[model samples]
Target: MPAAHAATPIVIRDIRLEGLQRIEASTLFSYLPVKRGDTFDDDKASEIIRKLYATGFFNDVKVSTEGDVLVVQVAERAAIGSIDFAGIHEFDKDALTKALNSVGLSPGRYYDKALIDKSEQELKRQYLTRGYYAAEVTTTISPLDRNRVGILFSVTEGPSAKIRQVNFIGNHVFSDGTLRDEMQESTPNWFSWYTKNDLYTKDKLTGDLENVRNYYLNRGYLEFNIESTQVQLSPDKKDMYLTLTVHEGQPYTISGIRLAGNLLDREAELNGLVKIKAGDRFSAEKLQATTKAIVDKLGEYGYAFATVNAVPQIDQEHHKVDLTLNVDPSRRVYVRRVNIEGNTKTRDEVVRREMRQLESSWFDSNRLSLSKDRINRLGYFTNVDITTVPVEGTQDQVDIDVKLEEKPTGTLSLGLGYGSGEGPIISAGISQDNVFGSGTSLALNVNTSTTYRTLTVTQVDPYFTIDGIKRITDVYYRTTEPLYYSSTTDTSFRIISMGVDTKFGIPFSEADMVYFGLGLEQDRLDIDSTTPQSYKDYVADFGRVSNEVPLTLGWSRDNRDSVLIPSRGYYLNTSAKYGTPITGTTFYKMDAQAQYYYSFARGFILGLNFQGGYGNGLDGKPFPIFENYYAGGIGSVRGYESGSLGPRDTSTGDPIGGSKMIVGNIEMTFPLPGTGYDRTLRVFSFMDGGNVWGTEGESTGANGLRYSYGLGLEWISPIGPLKISYALPLIRHANDKYQKFQFQIGTSF
Candidate 1:
């Protein structure tokens, strides 16, 4: 704007402001450089215009002098009244709004055309990442009252582009199929809809390229190179094809590996950590493992910042390479502080008590790793991480930070189930693994069925003593009516049992615990005319009611990676109980179970379980029939009726009980066809073999080992874990009762 006094400068007596709406005149005056009683000229007028425009509050600014008084006129920009999205199914509206807000396009902010265009581009980019190659974004601005505007982002997201094929030009040692297997992206397949492997994404392609490079490098292709990659989109923009050009150079062998660094006078121990030796095929994985092992070894000795580098010496003509592991122990640091984070509900002491590395102690990576594993085993947290951060201005000091993500530690369950042999069963349980954030546990469970009923209450204190011993107390009452015989006769016969026990667990190692307990138990037998002869004889010999004091000893070890969906590790549990003749019959019983899980490939796990039990009476007395072990059920052997594989009553032909039992299962679990690598839902194939044998009962036709093979589905549902299986019994005996289908909830095999 031209000043009225353009020829010369003028002395302003006052300043006048215009176009004030949402913004006040005082606010504008604070930003103005030309104030009241100040000299004004053409240069000052130009400066005033620039200053007002730079504030972003005004869309237009005009500065002029009226009779030596400066006049500043402005047209303020419209504030955003509202922001809306249309046809946004792929993204949440709030999420898109947040994204736009990141780029200065939200309600209450001055609307800018440049920011609108920028936000449109950003939205398009977001859709493109999700394979929406034909997505279009447009912005519309509508004037509202009070000089405000509403923005509408209209998105047209077309069909996603699918990967048609992935081709490799020059891979000699491996076929195109093998190379494609190494990449996550692939042509449409049966499982493509779920895994989205057929979706063409730039980030996934980049990662696939890196994986291909590593595949060749790890297989002794020292000079492997990806010459180029071409991603072609079809004319319709609905299909994508990727072609990678590669040069797989000749494979090289490792000539030798030597350690050359400060090994802390433990050269021999460090050398043993090297997995690759002389005359071996070159492998990048082994080299990386070797370096990490050396670094970890030094970390165990308080070298928290240790470094190990594998410097390779390549020979082209000889096709050989030599590796030199250079280790650097930078500094020996001690932990200055141990910081715990993200334990919102759990007490700090509950977590701190699990740490193996204490404050003001030497940093030991081994101890830190063990601490993480222990916390995970607590089953109270969903995620746990431990990291070491160097303390500022300290050469030999560091801080250990423990980060945790807590999960729901309480479970309230109500289950309704039906067993072919046992009839309708109802169960309910309420348990808390971390009660009151004190690392204590309490649980109550009740189950009732036509043939059996039980109630149990348990409490545990994990830190009963300062020495890491655990105390457990349990009280239970149970009643059972042998299903097989109950159906054969109209008479009623039942066994009632009640017990109270207390145990102490002492940790022998990181993975092992030993338990000792003593308990008082009472058992009563109610029999009628049609009662099984075995039970009648037992009562005749030992009386109808018995009370005893029992002593129990047990050992357990668990190191599974995940308790919910374990992919690797082993678990073992063994227990023995001896009934003393304090008031009744004396007997001995032992049970052992061992489980092993191995993950051989991605999303595939192999599990093996073995169980055995043996019981006998002491002092030449017969073992109590009520105390006999029963097998052939969901947890024992599938495809057979519960407790139906044991010796039977000689006359009634009903399975009575057994003094010895053995069971084994081999199962392979993999991802469900459409679930990808989700562990929550899976399918498994299993072979089960088991039986129950009695040493003194009448031999029935179902007394031998039974075998079955089956397929099962496992789902971690909202209520609990559910397992359903359909089995075909093998070598069926004429008298053996078979149940081809079985299912259970809130249990794991």
Candidate 2:
């Protein structure tokens, strides 16, 4: 230790620094308050030492006088050479590294004993948040060569604490079960392992508390109060119990509801939006909804910064509340610019063209929301967010920033499976929905099975023109040989077909499109002595080789909220294809289908589908066997074999697809019990009724309406979409084929 000096100033001729390895001498000079030419004193020397120590780059700093010169010495702290973690099983290594880096405890940084202790506490705190009440984190420092050190954190994370019981007191209007049902966190059950709702955390408890409060407030408990909540932990710290005590006040009713404040002379319009009325029970949910609606309505009129406040005046004597809505139309703003960001793969124009909200236009909340939805529907991004920022110089101008996280839009599918009908199948396909980020689609598919082999190539240009017209071209070759499962004799023949089709879609509206198609097809049949009589007859009538030209017209409308997982929407499609008499084979086919989806609750959906098709020979000839419609599969009636629902060949007992088809399905879809809001996985219950009839038979009758009820699971896996179902037939004929369990990979239904 240096001795204390007198309170006298001295003139310094020179100054020197010592004990610097990595730090520069100039760096030390910059922090010193005393200069060589300036007078030095004890106070100045003290300031120099204090500032150097505050830099956190030194372990010790001292200043002393040597003759007419001032000498400063600093012992630099050891730099961290490496940081390692041991016994860390609960959290990911990358995540922990980031957390430690955020607290200034990373490799290549100077080591501080105080910061090391703080970092340990932070690690333990994180474990606590994850319900690891018995977690222990201890840090060790190992000396290394050349004034460097290594930090090692050993963590012991015990079992996560589980909630054993939850009790609510002072609840008269609703039972404890009812209140518990409203909470997202709960005690252990069959699904606790997946949902983790049994685990207790401060954030979960806070959210649960809010939910409880909202339940009472919405039910007209005007003065509901949660007095206290106690969370008791077991002595072993593996179990927890929670108790919530509350005071349930008297229920209240609405005496009067009025709209005050700036209505902008639209009092009638605003009043119509109010959901509350006099004599109705006071509901906090309804009040908040009404307030938000009014604000949104104002936003539609260019008042983007509007505010609506619901002020409740309570009459204690009568147990009634009068509601007043106060609106503030802050300013009418216009958008100055629309900025796009975070698109590393997709082109700017590809995303910008979908925007309905243009720069320099008055801000419309509906248009902005529609723009975001349009971007989402493109399926190019996993997440999309939009934020509005007021312009720096003006109050009436704002900028819109669209931030997106892009996802892979290309898919490669490879599948190998065995089916009862198709002995073994192998399929491979590659598709690019956003080809080169130009928003074009190209796909190539090849499927080979014992019964059928197909090769197809398709390309689509969604923006064939600047007006949003779409063009699609397809070329395919397919060969099919029916296999006889019940007969010992090989009586089946092979049919080969090659076709090319081109279609153009013209947009009629935002959700509607009209399509026109033209195609040319050639078919050839190979028959032998043991061929089926139906095939022989067809070959005799239509010849072995036939050519046809088909003209198609179609109209479709889609308003689905999401193409992948639609919660609410409707889809309608109708198409007709006619084989002109000018061509070889003459036939006409007409089909119409409609589907509707409704989200009845947060995670529940109801879907209805109906489809019908009719086809016949135009010039009094038999309908083409190759163009017949088949039903009863995963996409149709699940309880029956694929393509085995129509008329059957007498001797072969094989399904010969019919010319008329009718199908209807009703389904209710909900999230899995423990999946939360994950839409990629869902379980659904469905009832399907469908059948096919020959051209000579009736289109509809109770006898032919095959019905099946089943439970199905759908998962959008990383490889592709997968569907599995278990079904039971409601009405079955003696000869009807039953396929109770069915599954398919790389397809969507």
lDDT of each: 0.87, 0.84
Residue by residue across 519-615, what tens digits does model 2's lDDT show? 9888888888776566677888778887888899999999988666778999999999987644456999999999899998868999888999999
Residue-pair clashes per candidate: 0, 0
1-749 per-residue lDDT for model 1 (tens digits):
44344678888898888788899888999889877678888778777777878899988888877887777888899999999999888898888887887888878989888888999998988888778899998888999998999999899999999888899998889999878877888888887776787888889899999988999888899999999999999988899989999999999999989998888899999999999999999999888998899888888999999999889999999999998988899999999999999999999999999999989899998999889878888899999988899999989999999999999999998888776556788999999999989899999999998888999999999999988999999999999987532346765788899999999999989889999999989999999878877678778878888999899999999988877888999999999999986666899999999999999987899999999999998998877787887777677788888777878777777777788889999999998864446799899999999888887535565446899999999988876687888888886877788888888765667
Q: Report the lDDT of model 2 for residue 386.
A: 93
What lDDT, from 0 to 1, does candidate 2 have?
0.84
Candidate 2, residue 166: lDDT = 88
Question: For every model shown, what is its TM-score relative to the native structure?
Answer: 0.85, 0.87
Provide C-alpha RMSD values for all models, in order: 4.2, 4.0
Give the range where candidate 1 is weakest over 10 consecutive residues by summed lDDT. 482-491
Number of the top candidate by TM-score? 2
Please name the candidate that would achieve the greatest lDDT relative to the true structure: 1
Whole-model alpha-carbon lDDT for candidate 1: 0.87
